[model samples]
Target chain A: MSPSPEQAAFPEAFAAALREPRSAIPARLAARPGVDPAVRFAIYRNNMAAGLGRVLADRFPVLRRLLGADFFAALTDAFIRQHPPAGPVLLEYGALFPNFVERFPPSQHLAYLADVARLEWLRHCALLAADAAPIDRAALAAQPPDVMARLRFTLHPSLAILRSPFPIVSIWRANIDPANPAVVPAGLPGENALLVRPGLVAEIHAVPASRADFVERLQAGVALGDATNLVGADLTAALAFLLSAGILTGFFPVSDDAARRSDPA
Target chain B: MAPRRIPSLSTSAVPASRPTPAGLSPPAGVGLRPPHFRAALAEPGAVDFLEVHPENYLCDGGPQHHFLTALRQDLPLSFHGVGLSLGGADRPDRRHLARLRQLVDRYQPFHFSEHLAWSSHGGTYFNDLLPLPYTQANLARMSAHVAETQDCLGRQILIENPSLYLTFAESEMSEAEFLAELSRRSGCRLLLDINNLYVSAINAGWDSWAMLAEFPQDAVAQIHLAGHDHCRDADGGSLLIDTHGMPVADPVWDLFAAIAPRLAGVPVLIEWDQDLPDWPRLVSEASLARQLAGNALAEARHVAIA
Candidate 1:
């Protein structure tokens, strides 16, 4: 339905007030005798900026801490103006914040900030993601030898593989937990983080390049043998890590179904 | 007050299937925040019941879900919603309604409530409960949306009057009249927020007590008390902001005291969303509300006997 002129004007004026610092209150709004429309409008503007800023801070605490309060507040204000939340769920509100940081001019010097933000977002996602029952080792052990090669594993719903060019995992851990203050030694390379929520607690594990590649391949729906082939010598260790971390939720035999339906060419 | 007539449609349409007495009793509670979850779970009966914003607990799994599940087993839950946008141009979002339904089904909360304001427009949702023009078109839209929300949840939901900073020139009806008509049309109840009434009264230059007298007391299913920030307008007059960051202001408490007796057996919630106090502090506020409610009930009984 088309909006009533009042309905149409109310949100438009309110939204403009929220976005622009100096926007006049729409003509339709009546100011109390003593109150200026600008003063009244500022309350809403402050609420929009501060509310979204809080959401960003809650999701990206380490980043906020690193940037300090004022800088973080200004950055979130700019981000909120650009992208007010698309929906009511604050849990998923800051998906683009890390990307915004990547292109944000003032923060360019801090090369690792975006990656750290990505790690934080991943952790946030892992925390709220659905719970999944881990695959039992005995169930996997019961699979026939011929079926093993064709098995395509389903990772836990909360599992996330994040690869960053900076030593983001250490930075994230150090910044988030004061006890484990990250001391970045010189000449350290990039890191890959494996995020998982086996139970209610979310955990982040650092993985080597080979294991990261293997996990990425598995995430891309590669079968067991194919994924293992991509990792070469790291296959055994990666599989052990996956199983131990309760990352694999279930698996299905892909080639076995085709093999049973027709003779191998 | 001659036992203000319960709207006949409300009595006939709303089901009496709710199993717990939580829906029927006047228990003072506080908004359940994450910081106080441990204290809340440890002593569920510390207050009469607990109110939580369903949007905060919409996630599939987390410590939030875990503790809330445990808390539900003890105290009755009130799924007060902040995101339904009932007065928006469009009907309530189907996806959000479904999520609310899932929560209602799981928790069986004794009360479900949403604001009378709109928060979303076109696709973007402003985090705040944005204001609405009380025009006939807007009223029709809001009433239909409330009914739809009630139908979706399969229970009567409470519509909260928003704390307004500015009034629209096109508003055709007073907030009380709009809310009363909405309750009549949609078979929904009211969540009369005392803080909001006080703030909006001051901000809009209306008499707070007179506004309370006009409010549909019989339809009030719950009451919300919160603290607001006092600011100075351009002309140096007092401007009240519903910050929900402090203790209930004295005037608001007075209004609650006056209104409490009229709306007997309605749950009162102390809402402190920002600068949240310690668990004991919030519990103390709830205890105060309980005392006030108890006194009001007694006075109401005394008047009835006399």
Candidate 2:
């Protein structure tokens, strides 16, 4: 038999009920003589909130630790209700969580907390970002002098750089590192992070403020010589660090890249 | 006492299954989580097969994709998806299906399966298997979504029965009847989650054996043996949550023993998602399932001969 016409909107009604704790349960759910329908319906509520909260907690442990379990749970619940996941890949979920915390009033006192969440989020993304083989110095040496000069080098897909007003790297390191938990020096102008997943492991290196722009520009598809000249800082150390860390994927001539982009096909 | 046959919606049109790996025989598998990756890699023969939630490996490339690539070389795979939202009114997401197709093409998994319940509503993915009323409209919608998913993957996908906390009063048929008709209409197979069967039976007040008897037994292709937790719901009434945290409880094992005779060559996965045990402990649990299936199948054969 067909369902009741009213039940046509069942999923929508059910979702609304689950999203709002104060909303009454849908009318049609029934249990046997002994079972309580309200209690049974709550299973969905608890599971939805608890499971999503667990994902947030797992992804942002420092946020959890910093906010403490209770406060983190409250914040997660608020975030979950306001901004539920838009996609099935949960790893892609909560991209806005860092932004959410930044705007959250309770966490306003912890200025670096939002940056830490951003760092953690980047680290999480790095761990799962698409794998790409980086060209070693040998591969670079194979390129001719002209290609090397105007090389529009492709960086590793996992590479990300974040600069924050507060010392996010020191704070993150202090929270995650147990062996050498260094005291986070407060009131610093900022600290920069260079994230790369060279292999399966994701590494977060502290980048100098002066060189962060150069690496970001390179990541944004700027050619090597132009990016270096644009920054016009002591970029030798940053370039050396990128090479040593295997962040350079491959490179082609700038003019060749421009020609390909200009082609309609 | 048999399930009602939908003669109009017979599975005659269903495509034949692809050739499965040799490991499918004597099949007992374990869910390979990240914690056991090293151990699972080191010893490929710990189980005949390995099952994983395809949602976890939907990303382009990672150590997980690498590990699955390596592991697939030695053992067969069962890709159980958790996010398809097959029972939803909306069509299955084409992008998710495309990614799944890529994985299927890349790995050539022996079996691909999703649940009968929906997990997405509107745009938000709830991330939990949510139930539906057992009505013909829901059934038709589910069948269409299942067919779309199977067509997209270019393979027959099994639909698993979800453990429900409460039954819908608006239902027009039994869960078994709903699933039977769904399979008949969609030409899909069934992944009989034995633990879910036991949990739903007790919570919804049914004789577990009677409930099991009502299932479309012939369509059953795979089995899931998992653990659950017993707790009081808000009303302080007994409730069994499908937590998959601990080892398989005795009652669920009893249910498995009863059904194993029907699952001769089917791969049974020991699913422990929460409170994860070490690799050795997981191996031991899988070994127990293998042992139980073996003994049960042997007894069934002996009884038939007698």
Candidate maximizing TM-score:
2
List DockQ, one per candidate, in order: 0.62, 0.61
Model 1 C-alpha RMSD vs. true structure (Å) is: 4.7
Best by DockQ: 1
Q: How good is model 2 by TM-score? A: 0.91
Q: Write the per-residue lDDT of candidate 2 for residues B1-306, one digit (tens) a residue.
A: 222232232222111222333222246789989888889999987787888888888786778888988887777788899999998878999998999899888777778989989999888898899988888889988999999998999999999999988788878999999999999999999999989998888788777888888989899978898999998755565689999999999988998888877756667889999989999899899888877776776777678889
lDDT per residue, candidate 2, A88-176, as tens digits?
88878879999899888987777778888999999998888888887757877787866776776778888899988887777777777
Query: After TM-score superposition, what is the CA distance of residue B91 in candidate 1 from its true location, in Å?
Result: 2.8
Off by more than 4 A, model 2: A1-3, A142-147, A177-187, A230-235, A256-265, B1-25, B233-237
Cα displacement (Å) at residue B303, model 2: 3.5
DockQ of structure 2 = 0.61
Question: Candidate 2's error at A144, in angstroms?
Answer: 6.2
Candidate 2 CAPRI category: medium
